[model samples]
Target: MTETGESGGRKYDPAATHNFPDERLNAILPDLLSDPEITTYLEAQNVNAVTRKGYNDHGTKHVEIVRNRALNLYDLLKGGDVGFNGAIDQDLDEADEPVIIALAATLHDIGHVVHRDEHVYYSIPLAADLLDRLLPEFGFYDASEAVRMKAEVLHAILCHHTEEDPLTTEAGVIRVADALDMERGRSRIPYEKGGRGINTLSSQAIESVSLRPGDGSPVLVEIEMVNAAGVYQVDNLLKAKLDGSGLENHIRIVAVNTKAEDRLVERIEL
Candidate 1:
């Protein structure tokens, strides 16, 4: 999918709703995926995290999931007729919204390349440098507009973790999307190698997470779990990210445990 998007404009994979529906995203996707610098940082982050620290997946896979969900959340909000324009304050066009989201989500954790302890801080400078190089490829915006977009994207990356209050709707979207990557396959590499840590346990409990338009809100996040333990991923982790995400009023979250328990955790005691 990334290969196709990189090669032929932004031809997204024909998965459920995975395509870049926004025209702005369609323009930016090809440049983003094809950037060797961006790809290097994405891969390097995982080396420090998954290899050295034994953390869950934090490379291309994790970023891809976050980028997809962030844009999907953006779509849901826009589809619900919410008029809050993330680009308005900066005097940019609304078409700039998805560009901010896609860049922020893709590079938010690249700071992990420096160290996982404060990867968010590390990501800002790295992302800024890459943005300076890549923004020219978008073409629709002027140099001044590109500068403002860079600031917005950096803000979203800065606020994606640690419960920082996100000032823009785009930043909030990135925060929530980061937390949404807590499903099973995300931690599979670590768990399969005999990791029984809490991160692995919680992710393993989550059978699936589906996001869609909500009945009452703009977005609905439905989490299906095989064991009650998955609640920790939501209650402690997702809740923390969502607390200051600025999407509190726009999104709904629901988690349910299936009656069918997988043998991985059929019987357990804390």
Candidate 2:
């Protein structure tokens, strides 16, 4: 499946996956691949059925998903005025920062290739190791800079699951983008090998997502869902995702399509 946004007709395929905006990534991939340990681990990630359902475990799909999703979120944030007011504006263009964000988002789920219980826990270390091993190849001054980048990437990758961690704008953007797609697709894929129905059943397709600024409190985001199934899914899973993505207290489900008639039901916020 291709990920395309309304703004740019750009779609990423595995065919030419390395057209990075920054050249720093070019220097890094070779070193990353040079380490047989990482290669071996990444290679063995496909044996599990659950891993097969995710975007990036064993194939190029995950990377493409990450890149497209990350870019899409950036676009949305900029459109929503969040970029100008948020840290993304400050850090997006810093040398290789976009690549760092894109790469982390792309690689964050590799641990799921092993186990789902704590994918973040495993993926972060792997990312750090890969970055360190590839530092020389990437032409970093020394292992120190590589380690710093690794730390930053790890911060973004690991914290994508929860907001408690130090959130760089790139990380926050990746987390939200990674999550928004759960409703767009992948919900029909079975979560377990022997799962009966759609393992990742979707709650709804969001018709709109809007944010309201507050005086002293946190930002408020209102989400509108497409159907009752969407409602069920949001209440059960997506809400947690919102909270985890650092929008829990800030985001609210304002309306839904209850009749399945594809007509939006509006609720007044009191």
Candidate 3:
């Protein structure tokens, strides 16, 4: 059921295997994705489309994208000795960092099952319950450790909304990764079906996002756009997310207009 392919010239696979630093996370991700509550939440977005208004998918695919990006950012920052707070800096094992980030990213949007507006607040309790049930399966039999992990993951999930600031490295990674999901496909359905205006137009202009280790920084985020409009997604949305993320200083972001010989429109560094 897993296959690798290119998306906007970048390699991606919906079923890609991520080697989590934590063996517990690696063993549990597949089961978590298949959990009835999680699957139903994702499906509810599309099934109740008429009630929700035209919106980009807030489903499993979106979770996968954010999960991958969050994990990649976490690994890059941790390897560079970027200081992280919350559970990462506390008594938790180093391997637990990726677990926290991945769980936060994966479950961040499930709150949409309640409603989209201010769903971040709703995600907290839902995510906490899921974590409580799932962590024990990952061998987190210690009550204190389970509570710490749930608290950290919920913080990251809560901070993903623009109104909240990420207080930890893992939360920052989740915030930025959530913003990075602004590629065209994300907005295509809404855009095609009368979802007019700046949000849709700007999102459609984005062609791809490529993340890699930077030559001069800990991480590089390269955004490719077909038109100047994509600037809104990068400058307004992504920038806001990164501004509050703790990783700002360790990361550099560049947005290029591919249709214009790769002209750089925005370059930001902390």
Candidate 4:
């Protein structure tokens, strides 16, 4: 974590990914994050998401948060005895699941480097290009395996947005994990810049979110809210992503206000 890589009051932390149990993921992450090509893409994306649109982070900080949450969610589901495999694609070895998740989460928003409008569609070609250059560098995947991995990663990126449906559990996990970066820190850019849109206001209301094993479900998403207004984030955005994420039945979402609800701005924008 460096002071320069932070934005919107959020600091990028690669520590959790280092703790991931997957040897392939652990080996690949340090190289992938430091790759000049990938770093360039993340910077360009912020130009669009932050400088262009005043949106929450979609750069290194955002990706790191999603990567951590995606892996943690995968771990909770696996530990809770869920039947779904992270590598839901039949051709992929079960061992490659975390690699798929980390890769997809890392590259998913690079398409934002192209444009924020339908960035999901733009991400496909860029990710495919990077996969070509990086997968071979790992010296692990043969040509055939590398091609299959490309399809899997592209699928996850496309499906992270609601426009596409996720066919694999891995894609679904990426979709849901993308939305989990909704704490107040993510709203600092918009809020500090004098933006009071609903997106920023609701996100600012979120204090923290945690994932753990659940008694009734494979995973529990417990959200701590500073005010009731944050419910809009859970019910409107998160619930939509979760509904089609295939892990819907396996995960439970609950939000609670830790204090008396404060008055949120009434002037709202979506």
Give TM per candidate. Answer: 0.88, 0.61, 0.87, 0.88
lDDT of model 1 at position 208: 72
What residue pairs clash in candidate 4, if any at all?
A: none
Error of 4 at 142 (Å): 0.3
CA lDDT of 69 in candidate 2?
58
Per model, state how many residue pairs clash.
0, 4, 0, 0
lDDT tens per residue, model 1, 1-270: 222222111123334353224677786788888788889888889999999888998998888888877877777787777664567889988778888988999999998988988888999999999888788877877899989999999999999996478898888989988998888778888888889988789888887777778988888888777887787898889988888777888888888777464433342211
Candidate 2 local Cα displacement, residue 219, angstroms: 13
- Clashes by residue pair, model 2: 55-62, 203-229, 203-230, 204-230
lDDT tens readout by residue for model 4, 1-270: 222323222233445433334667768878987999898888889998898899988897888788878878777776776655545555767658878888999999988877899999999999998999999898779998998888888899999999888988889999999998898879898789998998899998888777777878878887877886787888899988988888888988888777654545322211
lDDT of each: 0.80, 0.50, 0.76, 0.80
When summed lDDT is taken over every stretch of 10 residues in candidate 3, the lowest stretch is: 1-10
Candidate 1 lDDT trough over 10 residues, lowest sum: 2-11
Tens-digit per-residue lDDT, 18-41, candidate 3: 443556566666787778877777
Deviation (Å) of 251 in candidate 1: 1.0
RMSD of 1: 5.2
Looking at model 2, report the run of 10 residues with the lowest lDDT sum: 83-92
Give candidate 1's TM-score. Answer: 0.88
